[model samples]
Target chain A: MLIDVTDAGDPRLVDYVGLRDAQLRRPEVSRFIAEGVKIIERAFAAGCTPRSLLLQPRWLPGLRELIDAWPDVPVYLASEALIEHVSGFHVHRGALGSFDRPQETGWDELLGGRRLIVCEDTVDHANLGAIIRVAAGLGWDGVLVSPGSADPLYRRAVKASMGSSLALPWRRMASDSDLQRLRDAGFTLVASTLAPGAVDLAGLEPPAKAALLLGTEGQGLSDAWSAAADRHVTIPMAAGVDSLNVATAAAILAYALRP
Target chain B: MLIDVTDAGDPRLVDYVGLRDAQLRRPEVSRFIAEGVKIIERAFAAGCTPRSLLLQPRWLPGLRELIDAWPDVPVYLASEALIEHVSGFHVHRGALGSFDRPQETGWDELLGGRRLIVCEDTVDHANLGAIIRVAAGLGWDGVLVSPGSADPLYRRAVKASMGSSLALPWRRMASDSDLQRLRDAGFTLVASTLAPGAVDLAGLEPPAKAALLLGTEGQGLSDAWSAAADRHVTIPMAAGVDSLNVATAAAILAYALRP
Candidate 1:
């Protein structure tokens, strides 16, 4: 169904209203907004059901084939100015898709993976997304984010992940004690920490199954989480410098420890 | 010189005028703004000459001792609203400093280092800054960005670097032929490319002196730069995924190839 929407207040455009607001970031939100052409394509490729699409006419010709595949999906055509007005930001890449949230990966499926990234309160959307991207790109089987972490399917995260958050099997942990379950599953819990006596990452021989636990931005892995790890590893950094950003650190660790 | 500045148009704040403008991003710009208290402290630590400071009243006490040490440098106290008005953006970090651009690292000093990051048109400020941060944190000696790359001293880059840019020795290339100079210095030119048959980063033995080449966001390395490299290296990513972000790639390479 192709609908031309002239009014920014159109009730049908509800999915895209106030995109910059906090509502869309909530984990309970039923739909995720896929921004730009590439992410929208990835959303479809990941088998997400498209609820609707809001885009300018110039974006139509390129995306025509993709949208035509879903004939029942409403394609709301609007002007570039109206889109900027409706979304409360410039739709610079010039397309947006609202899709039903994909089902979360199950614990059994997640535990079967050889390698995983387990994030603790890694709440920054872009950083979390980058972690997911690197994890998937390097052939890591899945991601397990803490309860307080940002939603992987959120627009900013999806954009940042280049939609790898959709491609990878990620599940939000119910509680911190999930670490116990991982340990019981025959996986080595390696915590990235600054604690003295931590082994250098280069020297460590990675085990058959390992979960790399990353922490939030300011405070590193919480003391309890740090204590629970089977081993502690540190990237030996130069003197007088602060630690690398969490996402960058994840990339280095993921590359070095890839199964 | 403790001066309370009320008017946003005060002549003392000239270095901060229209901060969002392209002028501040230009390599020719004489001064750079250091946002937040930590980076300001880093600016002083890096021996950058403080031209002046624009900050809120609440922040004065904590920074008093540091500012008092440089009595000749004028401290412009203003309301957060006033600072935000002048800077054309909210100074949520609550402080700012205008510092005379530090002297660029010379070729002789840079070439003497065993590990270096050479960026080719890595123009995004935040990405370039992250590269510098990772390079420094991983103990890479210096950074050499191509002529077209963003200035390492640009405000956004400096902030993203978490003040590592202040501590690291980074210089911009005079021309494309600077790669030749690096090769002449006996530094192995390792190009991070996606090309087939590129040596997997896991297997390659990094030479003593190596300069890793990184490119821009949308495009990978330019053909000429890739061809000029002494060896091509790649992170073996999983099938069906786009490549890693430039900054993330830099982090992995800097760590793996660290001296």
Candidate 2:
């Protein structure tokens, strides 16, 4: 449905308003806003049902087939100025989409993989999404984020991942206790750390089923998590540098240890 | 050295004004501003001479030693709001320093390294910096950027590198012909590409001296450069994914091909 809107306060456009409000962007929230034409297309390709779309006419030709396939889905046509005025920020890509958030992969499926990435507290959304992109690209089966991690479905993350977060199998753990389930599945838990005794990464041959544990941005894996791992591996770096960015480390680790 | 200023338009503060002007931030510009105390400290550690310092009082105590050492350098003290207002953007890390642009490495020193990262048209400052950080962290000896690449010493690049860009050896290429110098130096020019029939990265052994060529963000390597390479190697990814982010690819390649 093509709905033309001139007013910023149109009741029908409520889903796109006040998007910067933290309450609306929470991971538990039922909807996520995909910000660009490519990401919106990815959302549809991944089977997400759109609640509505706000776009300038310039983007129509590229997205015509998608809008045609879903006649019931609201497609709000607005002038770029009105869209910016209403959204309170310029939509850089000039296309904004609101979609029903998809369900996360279940533990049984996420844990059945031969390779996995477990983020303990990867709070930065871009970092979390980048990790997912590399994990999926290199053939890792899934990703597990601790409760405190950022939402993989968040718009910036979705953009940063180039929409890989939408395609990959990922889930948020209920608590630290969920980690034990991986060990029960006959997986060797390897922690990426900079501790003194950890074996050089080049020396550690990955086990049959392996889960690599990554930590927060500034700190390496927490002591408790490091102590809990079946093996500890460290990337030897040049002197004077403290550590690699969490996402960069994930890319290296995922590629080096890929099955 | 501790001159307090209340005016946002103060004449001595001209260096920090209109910083958003691309003309001022150009790579050819004789100076680059370092935002935040940490990057400022990195500039100092890297032996770059300071032109001036702008800071709020809270950062004073921590920087007293360095301030005292450089008594001739003007330290403009201001309130946080004044600093933000004058700079036209908030300095998130609360301190900014203007420094003389450091010199780039010459061909002899840069090409003599056993492992190097060669960036071609990497225009994103953050990506360029992350590539340098990973190269430094993974023990690559130096970096050589094509003329069109982002400035390694740019503030965001410096901060993104966690100051590694300051310490790493990197220089600009006069033209693609600088690549010829690498070949003459016994450096194997390894091009990273997704082209058909390229050898898998895992199957190839690192030559005695290796140089990895990285391309622009979206289009991947240009045909000219890919054909210029001594060896074509690729990281085989899962189907449906087009390619890895240039920086992420650099990380995996640097780590795997590290000396």
Candidate 2 local lDDT, A1-259, one digit each (tens):
9988889889999888876556554788898888889989988998888999999988989999999999999999998888888777778868999999999999889878999999998888889889999998999999999988888888778878888888899999999888799999988999999889999999999899999999898887888888879999988988888898899999999988998
Please provide, for model 1 over B1-259, each residue's C-alpha lDDT reduced to its tens digit, 9 standing for 90 to 100.
Answer: 7899999889888887778888888989888889999899999999889999888877888888888999999999998888888888877666999999888899999999999999999889999999999988988999999999998988899999988888899998899998999999999999999988799998889899999998787788999999999999998889889799999999998888888
Q: Which prediction has the highest TM-score against the true structure?
A: 1
Q: Give the per-residue lDDT of model 2 (tens digit) for B170-233.
A: 9989998888999999999999999888899999899999999999988888888888899999
Question: lDDT winner among the candidates?
Answer: 1
Q: How many backbone clashes does candidate 2 have?
A: 0
Q: Which stretch of 10 consecutive residues in model 2 chain B shows the poorest summed lDDT?
A: B18-27
Error of 1 at B20 (Å): 1.6
lDDT of 2 at B11: 96
| Model 1 lDDT, residue A201, Cα | 97
